[model samples]
Target: MKTALQMSLAAAASLSVFTATAAHAHVSVSGPAFAGATHEATFGVGHGCDGADTYRVKVQIPAGVTSVRPLDSTFGKAVLEKNAEGNVTAVVWTKPLADVLPADTNYYKLALRFKVPDAPFTTLYFPTTQTCRSEAGVETTVAWSDTSGEHGSHDADAGTPATSPAPSLFILPARSPGWNKYTVNQHVHDLSVFNDALIVWAGKAAYSANPATQSLITTEPDTEVLSEIHPGTEIWVKY
Candidate 1:
């Protein structure tokens, strides 16, 4: 016979992924990547600046993400910018003037293959800048590089609308068919995203349907509960 906790955990789902793609959405990256795994992030561009056709797109790669290689884009040539340390700092895709005619008013997806950091439960942001050119030869740019607030404030996928939001997404641990263990690298405020998770716990702290009833935890005594899980805090979940 199976234990109640085992059955509950087995039936539970993995972590939650939050995105805020409302009106005036900026450049956004899409994916549910596993920790330390290779990911091909696709940044989506909806439109140009004030009806101007897109000419270039530059995406800034955050730290801890390694071995980045931008894929070829039909829109233009993809190039990478690297720091003195030999790490890729940014990936820029520029469309040729030949194709810019009649305005490349359509949406675009710029891809980059790389390895996410080993830290699980971390949200990484790729600050991006989009350049546009008008038929009259006027040029403009949109800096989608504000990585503040939830999921990098003003993100097209989540959080309060911002004037400029960075492209961001969570890199979580690879889960098995049953129960899985994870140690979060950031503070998570809401546990509701894991609604399917039957329970979550760390040390003596545990939560079933509400904030963990423990006063303090052995793992991370200060922030160990469903409502507030701090960094370096180890937790287990049912798949």
Candidate 2:
């Protein structure tokens, strides 16, 4: 909807692109959780390594997330691994040697619920590893703990570059008045979130939904300057 207000947008600087995990059936997570909210993180493993059967699954708990409790799974009870200071560091799920299935026949979903920290946050990834073993005593492992690369908060048309992508979670911050800096976890197209902000600044462009401006600086033809929100976009919004 075009409003009567003239919005003046300008270019800022060049930026890198971000691609989140979605199409890949290997490993992934669910989120964009609100700051300070309790979240249940689920790690989905679709297959074992090199056609071997899965034997163990380990997931590292990121900082600031509190009160983590692993949910039960068919693989058995969840084992808590802690740090020297008595803080739980990771969660493990193991399958007995006799129960190891062959190849990709099994899909595993292991989850842990925890309370998120209050805002002044962005994206979080729980580094996970999947270990597989064969009857002959051969063990193969695939670690989905890479935290490199970038993606849009919207997780748009792009796919992750990680061969074994870790399950990721996004944090939606608690906004404050005046200017607030945020990273986009989900793609945003509507300008409503910044409705009252005087102007928003992303990489090489600026957006103002103040409805009192008089121009546009669109990078793409027919698309608004702020239309494409990157997965890891750190944008500044003013109230």
Best by TM-score: 1
Error of 2 at 174 (Å): 4.9
Model 1: ten consecutive residues of lowest lDDT: 210-219
Q: Which parts of model 2 have CA positions greater than 4 angstroms off?
A: 1-25, 151-160, 174-224, 227-239
What would the per-residue lDDT of candidate 1 be over residues 20-94, giving only the tens digit for each residue? 332234687876567888988788898898888988999888999998988999988899899999999999999
> Which 10 successive residues of model 2 have the least lDDT summed?
9-18
For every candidate in turn, the CA RMSD to the true structure comes to: 6.3, 8.7
Shift of residue 9 alpha carbon in model 2, Å? 21
lDDT by residue (149-201, candidate 2, tens digit) is 43223233234455555666656566665568887666654443444456677
Cα displacement (Å) at residue 50, model 1: 0.4
